[model samples]
Target: MTSLGVIFQPWSPPERLRETAVAAERAGLDELWVWEDCFKESGVTSLVVALTTTERLRVGVGILPMPLRNVAVLAMEAAMIQRLFAGRARFGVGHGVLDWMGQVGARVASPLTLMREYVPALRRLLSGEEVTAAGRYVNLDRVKLDWPPAVPVPVLAAAEGPKTTALVGEVADGLVLTGGWSADMVRDSVTRARAARSAAGVEGAFEVAVFLMTDFGEGAAERMEAEFDRWEFTGERRYAALGSVEEVTATVREVFDAGATSVLLQSRTDSDDIEGFVANAGRVRELLLR
Candidate 1:
């Protein structure tokens, strides 16, 4: 069964997250995702609040940049949340926006190399194993989490490029597709991920989680069009849902049939009614359930 989710975009004020999270759960949203974009909210901090506040809503922090964090600290934080909330936590990591990384002096010459090494090490630590590795970017010495999750948490890696997608399939437990990819692009990405996993002899259910740029109600068309212009989105992969619940639900199903395990509806960052936007997520979920 494909699941539905909504994002509390980084551009929104962090103070706004709590109310919106409560509203989302109340509104019947399956999962709530938050960003760890540089100079914005701390993914771990915000997600902890979210998990503690909501009894059943699973909280996801999509793509915390490893460059800005120590793997040991990340492992500890993830373990804490998983232990506290059990099945209500999902965390992901990737190369954050490159320019933001550069601004903080955390930029690495090879992000792929960093993630290739970082993810496995983080996983090992979370599985209660001490990790010590010297790679092109990540290095740790005898680091291990004292209280790793009883079962290691499934970690998703953000990917849009083919190589990153393949690397994620080879290493991480899931893939987080960037928004603006068409259903066909989503299918092709799933295939590429599986191919890499199969070639590497890895086996298991690897999930494909994609973000769908969503627009609805008043001002939706102009919002969608402006987004396209801003993202410089062109070609067939500029995927978005721009109309009523029926249209958005159909788009979700199309992506699901094309091979997405979950679809997260992302409203524009400038959207003022964040809670209202999430409240409407229930509409999409309802149509999907039917």
Candidate 2:
């Protein structure tokens, strides 16, 4: 079955996370995800709070920016969390937003090279292997995690194009697609990722998790339209699902039918009903089952 989930946008203050977790857990939603927006809430810290407060909600820190982290240190942090809450967490890493990366002086000359070097070494470290490698971006000297998660934790990569999607197949266990794509776009991405996975001769399935722009209630349209204005989004409403719960439900299905192993509802950055939005995400999952 596809994993249905929601995003806790980092646009709000750090204090809002507890209520966010409470709402999703209480509503019986499947997963809760957060992004490590540069200069915003720390992704790992937010996951700790969310995972600790909820008994069963699986949380994903999708696409932690590689430029901002040391591969070994990132592995250690992920191991620590997964050990503390085994089977209840998901982690993803990728090239961060370039503008944000540059602001912090973490931007690299080549993002593809950085990800390629980081992923393999990270996998070894998390698997409790002694690894030593000196690459253009990542360098580790015979490092191994003293405390790795009991089982191998899956690593996901955020991808928008074919080359990066192939990178997901080559190393990562899953592929994450960001919001602002229509269902047709989702289908094409999944196809590209799978083809890459097959060509890589990799065993095991690769997950395609897409975040869909979704919102509901009275102000949904206005709030989302304003978001479009901020992003200078024009063309079509094909990518977003802004309306009542029933309307959003069908939109979720459109992406799912397009071949997402996971579909996460992303509330507009300025959305005021984040709690209510997540609470109703369960209805989308229900519709998918029927």
Number of the top-ranking candidate, with lDDT as the measure? 1
- Top model by TM-score, which number? 1
Q: Compared with the true structure, what per-residue lDDT tens digits does model 1 show for residues 1-290?
A: 78898988888887888988898899898898888877878888889888878889989998799889888888888898888897688988989899999999998999899989999998888889988999888789888777889876988999989999999999999999878989999999999999999999998888888899998786787878888888888887667977888888888899999899888899976778877778778888988887
Enumerate residue pairs that collide in model 2: none
- Clash counts for the predictions, in order: 0, 0
Task: In model 1, state the lDDT of residue 23.
Answer: 88
lDDT of 2 by residue, 1-290 (tens): 78888998889788889899888888778899988988888999999999998999999997699999999888999898888897688988889999999999999999999988888888888888999998998877889888988878888889877898888878888888887878888788788878877887878877788888887877777777777776676765336887877888888888889998888898877766777787779777776678
- Pairs in clash, predicted candidate 1: none
Q: Residue 167 deviation, candidate 1, in Å?
A: 0.7
User: How many clashing pairs in candidate 1?
Assistant: 0
